[model samples]
Target: MRTVPGRLRPRSLRTRLVLIATVLATAAVLVCQATGLTLMRSWLVGQVDDRLTDFRPPEPVYRDIADGTAPAHRPPPHETLPSDFRVYFYDADGRLLPASLGSGRGEPHLAEDITARDPADGRPATVPARDGGGSWRVVADSGPDGMRAVVALPLDSVEEATSKLLWFSLAIGAFAAGGVMLLGGAAVRLGLRPLTRVEHTARSITSGRLEQNVAGTSPDTEVGRLGIAFNTMLDQLRAALHRKDRTERRLRRFMADAGHELRTPLTSLQGFAELLLDDPDMSPARRREAHELIAQNADRMSRLVDSLFLLAKLGDAPTTEHGPVDLLSLAADGIAASAARHPDRRIALAPLGAGYGADPAELDVVEASGDPHQLAQVLANLLDNACTHTPPGTRLQVRVGSLRAGPRTGGTDRPGRTSTGPPLPAGTPAQVIEVADDGPGLTPEEAQQVFDRFYRVPPAPDALRDSGSGLGLAIASTIAEAHGGRLELDTAPGAGCTFRLLLPASGGT
Candidate 1:
């Protein structure tokens, strides 16, 4: 025979539980009823047997039988036997005997010698009548007059009682099954209320209600545990979705900023090409100027494209190849390059002073675990940004220090803000690299948005903003983050902006 699959099976938990309860209840009722009925039938039959075993014939009947004067095959007078019972007599030779003339001591059509010897005791035993009317329990023994006699009782009453008991047992089993179904179904429904709530919550989530949660009862209960687990899962899912939304917003802004940055260079290149192509009689100087403009715009576009590419790579996977990088040497090199590029600007390198809480030699030998090339780019970008943004001859300083107390080593414009970094094991020191410029400082808004891609601090009234592609600071920040560190800005209206880079110090002890 074919069987149904599991998926197609009944899905209601209450129904299944109630069905099991009903089956068990029915079985119990049937067993109890069967036991009781069997015992009752056994007791009733025993009563009949007892009566037959103790049966005695009257003195007159015995005397008549001894003298051979009693009439045989006649009904007893006055009907002394029970209505449903019969008595019989047998001779010494096991033949049917006549009853006393008017005593009615014979059962018609009942044969003498019907009693069989018991297998265990070799005594005359009660023999059941096989006729359809009913059965008889009979016993044979010697009477006072030495005449063998048999007493018999009908089994009709016991059969009727057993039949009634069978019906009663069946009724009780059916009623018990019905009661179990009703009560068990209610109990299952009540106990599974928490699961029902969880199901509702799941459906709500599927329908876009991510904030819904099941109200828990008690942690010690099974349903309570389920509720707690379900709520926790919902919270995690909500947080993940929130993160994805933030990422998408950032991606949209990145696209717009990239497009705007790229268009400016392209427009400049196009304008320069048009200017050179439109005038055949243009002076050599003018042509040279046009060529310079075209080359400059092309370089700008190339740098912007490169920065965008680097940002993309970092965003995709921030983890990169790692090695020990000498922060002091990298900072010095960047400072030297900046000084040479801007000879008119005052640029200096500052070793970690007493404020850094480290030995002077240790500051000079500051090293961090990171990608060397990326770290070099970070320092170069910060130096270039500082030089480009500040006035000519502004004092610029590059400070290399090991932070014993993290971002708190230097007081910030904002009291508690610090560069983001991976959590270090206790007692591990961090390396801080800062580029500070004593120039016209930034406003709060500019400081907040300084690291955003394509963001430029509104140029000073006397300075042109054309010097930057707006991607330098963003790229620097991305590189720092890829190396498991962060870039932070601290500045005020008058206090010059300081860009801090925090990275994990190399363990060389």
Candidate 2:
């Protein structure tokens, strides 16, 4: 186990695998040893039983020369008996015969359950010798006429052999099992070596080293595939962390910017109110002017606060008020309204198509799905931005078309119309609305940051700077994005900028 700052871990993979292998090997060895010992003991017992059942008496004991009865069958010689076997003889009246009759045992040693007429039938019976010797297996058989005989063998030899076999088997099995355990442990350790490398890499990652990765193994192996997956997950985690950090930094900057914007208006209002309050003899016109000024700044502060809150809400959830909105009509109305707001600007509407559309008043109907209010607000922002930035009498046009081609490239096509880029995928037409003006177009740097929140271009040396909150384009961009669309700027220095609003066409339009 390796120590991490606050984490206590378990045994390494190699150690766990070795322990598992050892347990398995021990189980296999035990099973084999138990089976072998059982079979060996049974075979040895059968051998001893065979010897007891096959024993035969000597020939003289079968003869009737010294007895009153004649022998029915002659038995084998004494020397033919097994070495550990002993025989017993009984007379016709069931009297014990002396050892001189060539019986091996000193006297009769049959158990009480066995009798002359009942001849044992070769079933083993434990017998105690009359001379008080060790246990014996005894069997009885009828001899010639009324004579009877019993055979007995001691148990010590059979027991000793079986015991020796058990010990030998145990000794061999123990040695074999030990050797197997050693080999199995080594094999397990070798097989899991790749996992060890992965563990080390994981440890490094846990300790804040996100860039570490396991490498150099074939992907075909299980461990190798795991390593690849682990590395991919690590990359995703690092990316997420980086994104979170960046978002936190942006939030801090946004807070500071918002405070500065609000503070300006509040200070202006406070200064004006304080002057009116301190001067008891202030003129009626002066008081009226101060009140107007305070009201103006107050309105500006309220707009900034509302925009900030809207931005925050947009980040959390999109507007749910949605329907099929005629984008062309919306842009037409926005242009007409801007014409009223800035009566000096020459604002007009047009239609773009493959034929270089002939009519501006009869523009093609282009529909998109979105909250109509939000969409209208987006249009207003674009028209207002153009009016405020451009010189008085600068000609501005709002072109509406079903874009077979997607968003426009940053170049002027005609006095009021700006051209678009290449065509979109077949059968999925998008709607494009371009707001173009002949005002001095933005520089490359300005174009890049125009959509960023609270960003405005530095004013030119001798030109009047427009009073703006700088969140107009940012809000429009956010709203467009929320509706699965985008707002793009196509501008370069000295070439008037075209802001293209691209939205997916609604169903049936």
lDDT of 2 by residue, 1-509 (tens): 65788776677666676667666776776677778768876676667678877876645665643353533222344434446666666766776554322334443356434355566557767656567655677676677766667777777666686678777767766776677668877887787788889899989888988888887666899988988898888889989999899999988988888888889999999999999889979999999999999999999999999999888888788777988888778987888787787777777778854225465556667777888989888889999888777766667888877654322332223233322222234445567788887678887667767887788777544333664788999898888888776677767667777787777775433
lDDT of 1 by residue, 1-509 (tens): 57667657655887878888899989999999999999999899888877766665665665666676655644445335444445455655556665532222233235645333421221324454554455667666565634566666667779999999999999999999989888888898998988898898889989988788898757999989888988888889889989899889988998988888889889999988888778878999999999998999899889888888888888897757788888889988887887787777776667666334545454467778888888888898998898788877677888887765433454222342333334344445668788888778887667767877788887765553565878888888888777766687777877887888877665532
lDDT of each: 0.73, 0.71
Best by lDDT: 1
Worst 10 residues of 2 by lDDT: 410-419
Q: How many residue pairs clash in each candidate at the backbone level?
A: 7, 1
List runs of model 2 lying over 4 Å from the truth: 1-13, 46-79, 82-110, 114-165, 180-192, 202-210, 217-222, 346-365, 399-432, 458-465, 504-509
TM-score of each prediction: 0.70, 0.74
